[model samples]
Target: MTDRYVQATMDVLGAARDVFSGHDTWRPLEEAIDAQLPDDYKALIDAYGPVQVNGHLYLEHPANPFYPLRTWISETIEDFRDVDWGEEDSPQFGGKAGLIPIASTDRGEYAFLAPGNDGGQSRIFSCGRDEPDLYEHRMTFAEWLYRYLAGEEMFSPGHRDFYPGPVRLESLPTAAGDRSSKWYGQERST
Candidate 1:
C-alpha cells in the first residue's frame, strides 16, 4: 500500500534507489505531533530530503537541523489559526488529530496532511494563494506528490501544464549541511 505511489514517483523522478527504509527517524516527530505520517511520504523525504521542485514548491525535511520540523509545524499551524478558511467549520491544526504542514510554495500555496474524515488514513489538504477554502485530496502523500510532479492540477485551480524541461529536483543544502556544495540536484532523465 505504501510503496505503490512512492515507487511511481521515484520512477518518474529517477531519485536515488536507496531509501531510508526505517520509521525510527520519524518517531520523535510523530510523538510530538501525536499523529503518524504516511509511510510513502516518509520514504520520499528520506530518499530526497528537502528539495525545491522545479524551483518553486519546497518540500520540508523532518531531519533538517537548521529548521526543526517541530518548530516549523508549530509556526505553520499558528499562522493559520486566525485565517478565515471560508468554511463554516474549519479544520483544526496541531492537536492530537489535527492537520500538519508538509510543504509550501513561493506563491503562498500550502500542503497539509490531514486525518481522514472517513477512517484513520491520512490525506492531503491544500490551500492555494488567496484561496480561503481548503481543497481536499483523498489520497496519500505520494499519490498527491506524484500527481503534482506529473503536472496534474491537484492543488491549484488553473491549468498550468508540466514543466517545459525535465523535472528538476533542487536539493536544499540545509538537510545536508556538511556537504561542500551549497546546492545540488538531479533532473529526471529523458
Candidate 2:
C-alpha cells in the first residue's frame, strides 16, 4: 500500500506516470540489513523511486546507479560512527537496526532513523553536516515528510526551505542502463 503521506503529497504535487523506480522485492534488503524497515519508508521509495524533491532533497533508491541505498547508508554510518553525540539518547551507527539515513539534501543535511524500542516505529533525526549533534523528532517517517512538505522547519539550518507552492519531483536514474536513456535524462525544474 502507498503511504498516506506520500500519496497525499503526490496527489498535490504530481508523480511520474507509468514509471516504477522502486525495488521489485524487499526481502533481500531486509534480510541483509537484519531489520524490517518502516512500511512508510518502503512506500515512499516505491511511490517515487529515486528523486530529488524540490531540486535539493534527494531520496535514493536501492538500485540507484549513482548512489545505491546500501552504499549511502554505509558511507554515512562510517562517517559518524565514532563521533560522540554527547546526548545519552544519541543512537550509534552500525547495528541490526541503527541510524539509517533516509534522505539527504544537497547542503549535506541528512534525515536519519533511530530504531524504536520493542518493535515500535523508528523515529526521525536530523543532522547537519557541520554540526556535532543529532536533532530528534519523535515522529514516524510519514509524519516527518508531512511536516516537511507543510514547510514547518524540519531540516537543519542552511538547507533550502521547502519550495514555495506545489512540490516538484524530478525523477532520477534507477539503473545503469537508464543513465544514457533520454527517458531518465531530463530534470524537471521548478
Give me the candidate number with maximum lDDT.
1
Score residue 76 of candidate 1 by CA lDDT.
90
Instruction: Quantify all predictions' global Cα lDDT against the true fold.
Output: 0.72, 0.68
Clash count list over all predictions: 0, 0
lDDT of 1 by residue, 1-190 (tens): 4458878887766645232344355888888888777788877787776667777787766767666666778899999887876777788987666788888888888888886455855579888876877788888889898888778887767834377546676666564444422233335543
lDDT of 2 at 38: 83
Clashing residue pairs found in predicted model 2: none
Per-model RMSD to reference: 3.4, 4.4
Worst 10 residues of 1 by lDDT: 180-189
Count of backbone collisions within predicted model 2? 0
Cα shift from native, residue 161, model 1 (Å):
4.9
Candidate 2: lDDT of 28? Answer: 63
